[model samples]
Target: MSGGGSWRFECKFCNTKYVGAHNRVVSHLLKDGGKGVKVCPKVTPQQLANMSKLLNDCKERVKNAAPKSVPLPSSLRNAATSSLDYDMSFTCSNPTSSEVGLKKRKGMGTALEKAFQNNSKEQCDGEIARMFYIGGLSFNLARNPHYRRSYVRASNIPGYVLPGYNALRTTLLQKERKNIELHLQPIKDSWKAKGVSICSDGWSDPQRRPIINLIVANTNGPMMLRAVNSQGEVKSGEMIAELIIECIKEVGHENVVQIITDNASNCVKAGALISAKYHVIFWTPCVVHTLNLVVKNICAPSLQTRNNDDVYDACKWIRPLADDVSLIKNFIMNHGMRLVMFTEHCNLKLLTVASTRFASTLVMFKSLRK
Candidate 1:
């Protein structure tokens, strides 16, 4: 309250008193730089003390009500710990291609400029490590284990290594296999130029898995090797024919002069079709196999019994022993004339068996000789 009409005293803490008219009273009350002042008449000491205490309590309440303090973890020792001033990144005012090498990081979440804002050495190293660990696997950066080691070690990112390794190895294997196939194409082409022969037989391996091998020979020379047709599926004659045709086309049909094989009906039919289409002759079976066939037919019954006993024993003994040059030489040294006669006789028999078409003669000779 003031002495003037409809006026108020101003509290120094809150400058919310009447503006114009209360100026004089405000000045009088706060004469010393707006500090609180007191004026009273017939006032007791107890009353003055009570008034001062009330004013002090009001001031204290206002101070306490200003803003509530945020509770923090007890583990935080410093009160200023809550005032975390985030470090600011510096921007390059001008940058050139020479300063930063040109390469696009496609799947990277942030651009190099953003990742390494001011191009500090530490920041640049961090960015590179991240790129290698995250982008390397996908972009072929971590294809080598050594690169992966360097990246992981530099980045201190052990967690990212395994996934990156798997990605890198898978891509590498795929690439290596593709390259190998490309290199083998030249060998296939060479074989085609010289003409290839086919050797087809149905056989089972130790696991009883039926598979066929297609062998090719040089029409010009004695070089022969297996045919590696990755796309071949040999089920029937037509399927086999397709493989032959593909090989012919690869090397050229004229280069493929002949396909030498046995008289298996399917084999014969397949050869006939190939020869007809490619204008290549199919040669007859080997003479050695033909002799074996003649012998098998001749003594089917009698030789079957003998083959179980004497003939099998004689063959088991003679073939391997005679085939050994040292043994033959030793025999010649011991019985010179007789050994020479025997050698001549064996050669004559072999020639006769190879040339003759009679099955009975081979059987009679086998029985007489043994």
Candidate 2:
């Protein structure tokens, strides 16, 4: 209709005009919503089917004639999210070794793909969420320096190949360990002048084994010395003392100022033995442990009996009031609707009291008050 020589033909069905390319004219008549042009309202099911086949055939002819325009294989396109071997990376670019990211040219997409192209942030967030869900990783991991650093490094490196599993455990592990040790050398060296404290803590493993960890601390910071497994044996003074003595010897007895431990009877006995062995290295109770014990006594007094010796005996109302607060906390937290309402009125989160944590009752009280 636009030109005289069979060019720019008009759709007979919908009266929509287009240049006589079979794809545009047929697709316009087919009422396909994905195409940019308005769909033909008059298109029938039979006409749509025929036009779709014709469009596909036209695409096939164009693709056959233009092989260079075809996208890279799916394997290459998906390389963005997969692990890459280090050998595949270019040494010349000196890109940090990291997770693989796609390196193919970004170009035009279908109408639907283009519609979602601007949602790259959401897509990245979804992938991160999926990873956390699949691995059961802690949400706090997002706050870790290494977690953000890894993403930063990955973004800079395209088509990065991840190190092999064996390399990760053996070669790369040793390399990283050495690198960390090098950085810690100055801190370790400060032990000679600042006089590091040798602190020990005991934890029960899943198998009910007693694991004692020794930490060396100074003005510089703390570092893990080692962990000793008590193998279901009693955590007696002799056994625990032996581990602390070994650590002291390893660290050099002259460099150690004080031995810190929890107020457990066994740990107290161990500290006593260590003090007797080295007069210069005194024994001190862990401050946090002492604070936790004090909080427990004040907030959750014993109910078996009350006498003049009991601290809460004079303040008879403290125990029942504490129990009532605990009940209220549980009531609100256990019900979703109550919790939502509480959040709406007060932004403060309800913190459950924990025996191991210092001042947990005080923290819960503060939250409730706020």
Candidate 3:
């Protein structure tokens, strides 16, 4: 205890002495001590009562010393004392013509008024139509009740008219065709003398229907010429040659400088025939396909070492490694459980298989090595 009747306390945990307040000493013992210091866990009932009395006295002193607020004026006091409830009906002195029109139009209700004021329906319809076109939505999408409800919800503007499916389809299709033609006209005109290269590829669709796609490339850009279904006909060298000739004729033979195709046997024969038929225009196999073939041959196990020399036998060593890689890839891809485990454990996606390209195998191996 200190002089002049002041109380002094010392923390048992840290030997820290505090004067005039046991609370400070308690707080210090609890919070500010080092790891070695053990806190004093006991508090007597008398000490707790003394702390509570001290807190109450401090609060009373603060309340007594605080400055009092000035009394409000009679008018302000009356306003503040008024009840919250008020009459809804009121008189307007000089409302404008627009305000009068709005009041008259208010009979239609607030929801309709807001919708008509914003005109969001037409804007939303245009955007939705654009989204449908860009995403290639099916015609049957409009038949869905959910879709119709969504459309109605979005098109809440007054005087908004929704187009029928047939009308929308006809209008949008014609617009798209006209837009494409307008864009292609300048390109065609620019390439009139320079001529375009025709790149063609054949592939089978999901239903096993063979489709031949032709793209004409010039300085402007590459534009699709056509996609022809050749499923029923024999896909022979002669048939492919005839197809190429027909495409060339349609594109104007004088405007086509070169033709490109994959190096398949039929395609090779077709190119030869095309060159023979049109001496002015050149025909060549796709360079990418040729390089892919070269890589395939280099990596093939059939490449035998002629002499036991390391230089010539390098491929012989690579062949087994490639075969092992292919085996590993097949093990991971063919088994669903293993595939999931591989993805989870390795944190990587396996390379997608592309049967037609040898480069794909090389890429897969490289990814696996990484």
Candidate 4:
């Protein structure tokens, strides 16, 4: 389509010239008894009415809906706010990953008109910048598809009213959820045949509150189910088992094959409870976590009986050695000059064994061996 700002337009149907674009283009297509622009001679009555209703709705929304404040899609807000920041919560519905960055618009009538459009877009960009600054919203939000699309839609309407806060949180939120659910229908439909696995893991957010994340997966791929905050409530085997049962019911018991969790006793108990409740399904420990545990055990110092004075464990030196390695890694990484000197001596950086993941000790040992 040519630029909406063009003062000249040729009607494709009749090859007739018009003085404006956009609304005028719309005005030209449907018969309105020549209200300063000739209506399309070929347009059916039903088509004219439909076009008029669309235009009327566009005009009415600005007058009727502008006073209320509503939120943008949670795909942008929740993803930027909680998901990627703490690195546990996953992006599920309404992903902002679909955003396509803006580009220079095409099909301009002249340099003067193009300059005007460019300047207008720059002003809009200024408003977006101001919005981020004033609201303390993430700059990453601009990357969302809706960020530009909502503005483009608003611009097309003469006096388009923005949705209210109540509408955004209530009506529009529900509407968006339904839309996203429709997109997820294919995955939901595959649940029965393939038998999905229910996987969960624990995390702590920035506030340090515990979170239990759930995801459902088959051969297709993983889909995040939910993230529950276990703040005030006690996180026990029974408590976690309830959550698993709830999820099983939601996904349908027939569709669930197994539940996967860490090797913690409580989680093991939870799995047992789930297995007992749903006879068709079973519980299993995460394979990676299990292997990590094996690595951690292998790296531990050998055990010895305190009653035997003559007995000396073969791995008595290992405990102190691992501790010394950890201390050295920390010291080198914390100091700038020490790190520089260490890097000068060895090209490979020392790896710190994270207590969170047991396999990190193996990685640390590998670095030391180099």
Candidate 5:
């Protein structure tokens, strides 16, 4: 019991000592190590009660002696208190009207009593109109008589002004576009000295109308130069080369450093033509598209496989697995019930393979395996 400097308690009956905190000492007295050891007859009711009381007193002293938190600054405290008062004032402008109604109705208050009461209905309505514009809602929604009435009714306030369709279309839209153009002017000017790279890509919409987009990239960022509808015209290498040359003229031949396009035969020929036309500008294929082609080639099955060739047949297994993965993705995505079941059973969402990029197939398979 006296081996260490810390206090220790000894069981007088068995002479077993416990050293450490007072909780250990209390446990020894109450349980006497349970059935593993005999109870100490020397621990009386009075002694147990005294020890319990002392332990509680020590805890209370600790609780009371903790450092009190510093109060908030007087300015902040006053501001917080005033905010609550302001909210109450808005809600209780006519307290007598409510109390008189309460007496007449006998505890059946009107439902309108719980509604938000505000003096700034005009400001709130203006904010709603701004949000509608920012959210890209159709301008015709404002002109609809029923929708306008419904919106006003939902606010439960009078004289809430909604933005007019004509004003939004003619005035506000033009002003916003003008402001954006003003901001973009400085960015365009900064790209002149450092030179820019031009990237072009062509794709067809769901209706099969061909569209070509041109983008210019510089130290600042990429900016769309133009998007043209090919209008069912032939997109030969000469046509594409002409389009690139026209964009370079607009961007200034001196300010252009390079042109990048996908590795299609027509695009490659177009790039070569552009390089020949402009001696200073270099032409290169898109690195991402080239790498994707490499992956596609590696995964393609050997077309010249002969019968009884085990290695060639084994190498062809990847094509079927890739196809199966695509099929499963399409099946689940095309059917709502199957999609829900797949989500519940697998706990993973299916990813679609991108037809334009072969790398997407590899990623889709990896996610399916996971």
Candidate 6:
């Protein structure tokens, strides 16, 4: 049954039983251990030697057989090794490829580690900074890197010493404005192109410092953007007049046509100059501005004659009723289609009032009502 708790098997020919440890069957057969389970317990030693020799011959064949070798060029092999080392050090480390034990580690230094150590600190820092700058620039120009990588590259180190592209843009704009007046030299003999149309508008920066842009439609299509003085006490009349004259001089005074601007008083004063100097007409304020003013007037509470008292009272009424979130939500849910129709009509009216406003905004507002 069992020898040392190992199950025993009998040989069919010799009727001999043998027992051994687990998984020892295959190896024990190849060795002389299989002789114990032979049918004949008194088998000749010569026969046993012949069986052992046959097993040994089979093992030699297996061991001596040539394995398939992957063909690789020497150069390619070296390059692949270098790439693998780089990946293992900087990119990734596979558990199977990791070095083991202290026996083979006697002064066996990594080539990559040695190269890194050989590099000067300043050189490494500069290289890192350069990589960051390059990565950031490539991301902005082509948007190749992901958002995180782009941010990392842009914010890295001494490479990004400048505030940002936005700051550089603003600086460039300021510099251009100072020297732009000189660039407005009148075109030679361009007085024969009839009247010129001028477009002017004042815009305040984030800091609330106003800058006026004066664009003139000369015989040629569009002229450069010129700046108006915004330093001293802000005077609407003075600002408009200065902008008009500058545009007029850019395009010859004789060729001066109508000047267009929003309904700002200063713009009105500026427009009036072209009419006075060159007999050019001052048209009504810009259509977009007129539409905004019309809307404001329609909504104004001062139309009731009580002025501030009526305005405050109207605000108190509207804020509580129309501004109620739950009421608005309910109305939208119940009469959403009707609200969309009404909004569409309102947008059409607005479009007719200012033809320049984007239709997409109208559609957007219609959806928001729902």
Highest-TM-score candidate: 2
Model 5, span 88-137: residue lDDT tens: 23233354554456535653234553353222453355455656776898
Clashes of 4: 6
Model 3 lowest lDDT segment of ten = 70-79
Candidate 1, residue 65: how far the Cα is off, in Å: 62
Every model: Cα RMSD to truth = 31.2, 22.1, 30.7, 19.4, 31.3, 30.7
Pairs in clash, predicted candidate 3: none
Top lDDT prediction, candidate number: 4
Can you give the lDDT of residue 11 in candidate 3?
66
**In candidate 6, what are the lDDT values of residues 1-370, reduced to their tens digit?**
7767787766544565567653344334433454343234545578667766876797789887856332221111122255332211221122223232221343323576457553233344445455667567553543555555855776676566635688768986788776764555453234355456777777777777877787766565567457665756576676577767776776666666577788877677766765676665554578777876554443333445356675556544432433353355456546969668757765532112123333333333344454
Output the lDDT of residue 99, model 1: 22
For model 6, the stretches where C-alpha displacement exceeds 4 angstroms are 1-194, 218-221, 281-283, 299-367
List lDDT for all candidates, in order: 0.52, 0.76, 0.71, 0.76, 0.74, 0.54
lDDT of 2 by residue, 43-82 (tens): 7799788877877898899888884421111222234454
- TM-score of model 2 (CA atoms): 0.58
| Model 2 spans > 4 angstroms off | 1-133, 137-160, 204-210, 229-231, 300-314, 334-346
Q: Residue-wise lDDT of candidate 1 within 1-370, one digit each (tens)?
A: 5454555545444444543354344344333234343332334567556655766797899999897532222211133435542213333333334323322223222476457543454445555555656555464654768776875585686455444677668987798878977876665667645566555545555665665555556544343233434334556666656666665675566666677665566666777778778665564554555666655543343446454775566445433432353343455547969767877766532222222344544443553355
> How many residue pairs clash in each candidate at the backbone level?
0, 4, 0, 6, 0, 5
* lDDT, model 6: 0.54
What does the lDDT read for residue 278 in candidate 1?
68
Worst 10 residues of 1 by lDDT: 70-79
What TM-score would each prediction reach against the true structure? 0.31, 0.58, 0.55, 0.57, 0.54, 0.39
